[model samples]
Target: MSTATQVPELSVRVRDRLARRHPGALIGELTVLPGGHSGLTYSVTAGDHRYVVKAVPPGQRPVGRNDVLRQARVLGALAGAVEQVPVPGVVAVDETQPAWFAMDFAVGEAVEPVLDEPEVPAATARARMLEIASVLRRLHATDTRTPGLDAPEPLDAAGELERWSRTLHAVPPELRPGGEELLARLAADVPGGMPPVLLHGDFRLGNVLCDGERAVAVVDWEIWSVGDPRIDLGWFLLFADHRNFPQLGHAVPGLPSEAELLDAYLGDRPALPAMDWFRALGRMKMAAIMGHNLRRHREGKHHDPDQERLPPTIAAMIRTARDILG
Candidate 1:
């Protein structure tokens, strides 16, 4: 799907869905939103109201036009049950309009990939992160039985090995160099399966929002999941370990020091010897995800800068994993 044209306005199908569900309504602040992997978002306002219109990937449309409804249903089920940053409530999910749905727009600037030239401070970033840790702790403590997630398993050495091996294989063969070795070393290096908890499938700094250095909201639920919170933990440690990516730490000051945040996460001292292994795992998983995602772009199936950067970044991550694991 190309963004070349005036992103084909919401089709009649979505409009009809809204008409039936909402009765008297008109779309307000309705415009295409930027950034997302599987879908497009629209800023909508109807009759003194604003909402976010969501849809599934243009090509992977499901039979019976259900993604938009499915997404809203899943989120609704999770309401008040977990410790997420907060999302818009379902306004009226529609399936008729070319695979799209709608929700009241949550207010806040996305804190991902970096905001702009003026740049936000790191210390403020730290303070916000403490809030993030607190939220994750709440999620980890939740007992909601969401069907979207599979049951939790012990994140033992063997499980990590099996999981990453599959993730590594998902990477194109051309992109699989030192990744295997790093995964091998990491397979043996385990965290003793810290008590099971939910996993935010694609948790990352980019999925958050900041009101000055405090994370006011967390978005993105395509992969909201269940498993060891460690998956989310490992992802953050890899993606936000300011030590490995000092530029990020320095770039965002309110961000808490790694030690302080980890201590808070564990509510005590950390026992893992090498945070790098988890870092490697996170990087590898991203690289592999990128590889799978890029093929769609390369095959004239999709076009997006975010998707395009995968090949090279995948290589960079492989190298980083090898260096850190070695």
Candidate 2:
């Protein structure tokens, strides 16, 4: 970090750290990344290596907004983590200045426009999907909760229902269709809840970093929380639940059938919903969340495309919900 070359435009702080890591580590082309709910992310390259720097916005860091802090904790605890899957590494984290840190970046596209061959193989997709299931099993099996991140919450059957209910209630009328009945059934029929496991607050295809058909790293932790293991299961169904749900399964291989995924998740915990019933709840939750966001954006508040998709997205959630509940 040459005081002389520390130019603000190039993420001067990140530039300084790279130089320190390798002495030969030289900062090169800087790229800006968006789609994150909190703070900014940048891809910085030094020499032949690429790294991601995530930090709190200067002065925008709130008391509870400790993403930079939580990342450091998780990455450090899982440091030297070697699973079939890839995970990010924490190189340097600075909590004080710039509210920043850097990590060894995994090499793969973070988001795919659609599930394609290179991205997913139908036969292998199922196996790899199971691999992903194993990863979740391991992450949740551990009792370690990060210090600064939100404290653990109830992961039982009923809690998941109430949680989604709160999210659904936030949505306005015109936006909410058949979501109520779907939610009620899910609430009333609480199955044997899974053991309290580490839940990725947001688990979906879009957040995965893939090296060919396998998930290299699960990115985007701005919403990471410790809660019911079922949340992750429910979340996965949002995208990969039904066999004929979306054309998303065609090009993507090895994807477990909706029944398979649910069985794998429930394991010995409890019986799962009938394939159709599980599919309905999965889609309903997705819609409820989108409806909430759509409501916010309609009022001229939230503007992310992902958020903007809420209104229409929930319609699909409702359609699928009705089909399942009908």
Candidate 3:
């Protein structure tokens, strides 16, 4: 059956599970939401409320990004935080039979493909980016023992490198020329002593919901972990470097520069270790991610035409990482 015809059937499946969690409520249509890179998402309504539901596709192992419960745990913890971190509020969850959770549907505009939005004035975009940096700083300050995070063992700089290495080693050698050399350099001089905090994993304008000039909420917690804050800061800063994404655009008109972002994130707080290694590690991680996705695209496991254009970008990331490491 065509995808259009199948959505309703799939919606019914999710609705049934949601009904089990929120018994007696009259649930509405579970319309499939677009643009989730991992896990299944839907816009659902029950009684007078609306929600966004995330679930692992049926019969698929609920591991990695597909683990909706894990994402929910973070959201649930942040929801009750003494210092509010802008995030969705969890409403209900069902762990049995195709694990799924519902969060209050965030109401705001999505500023994804951040660089591609020319209509949004550069000042507005830059302001929004600065706002996001402040929010990230708040999240980093949140207690890691916030109940649902499981008293996490934070990943140090070395652990961060090893985590992405697994993905790097899985790809074709040709796709990542200086991959091993980069990994070795990163491993040799692992920066230490930064206390781990709640990391957004993927922190960028695209992952947030914005209302006017403000970043109202940060969404998508699939890879959230306890790690050196720079891991998130470095990754977030990389987006401002147009060289990393040649396919996106040449000039970032209004987006905050990397230095500006770092300054905003650091504020008056004492500086941690130099971010060069972390920056290099971020690029390496990006290259590995693009390489893995490119491999999957070619193998027809995940067919996205965009992945076809990533080879040059991947090469550029590795090259840039080397330059940063120097």
The TM-score values for the models, in the order shown, are: 0.72, 0.77, 0.89
lDDT of 3 at 81: 83
The candidate that wins on TM-score is 3
Q: Check candidate 3 and list the clashing pairs.
A: none
- The model with the greatest lDDT is 3
Candidate 3: misplaced stretches above 4 Å? 1-26, 113-119
Instruction: State which candidate, 1 or 3, has the greater lDDT.
Output: 3
Displacement of residue 38 (Cα, Å) in model 2 is 3.2
Query: In model 2, what is the error at residue 323, expressed in angstroms?
Result: 6.4
Which of 2 and 3 is the better model by lDDT?
3
Q: What's the C-alpha lDDT at position 145 in model 1?
A: 61
Error of 2 at 229 (Å): 1.4
Off by more than 4 A, model 1: 1-26, 57-59, 63-66, 82-85, 94-100, 113-118, 146-177, 190-195, 241-254, 268-277, 290-316, 319-326
Ten residues in a row with the worst lDDT in model 2? Answer: 1-10
Off by over 4 Å in 2: 1-10, 62-66, 80-85, 111-128, 145-150, 191-194, 241-254, 263-281, 303-313, 319-326
lDDT (0-100) at residue 263 of candidate 2? 69
lDDT per model, in order? 0.60, 0.62, 0.83
A best-first ranking of the candidates according to their lDDT comes to 3, 2, 1
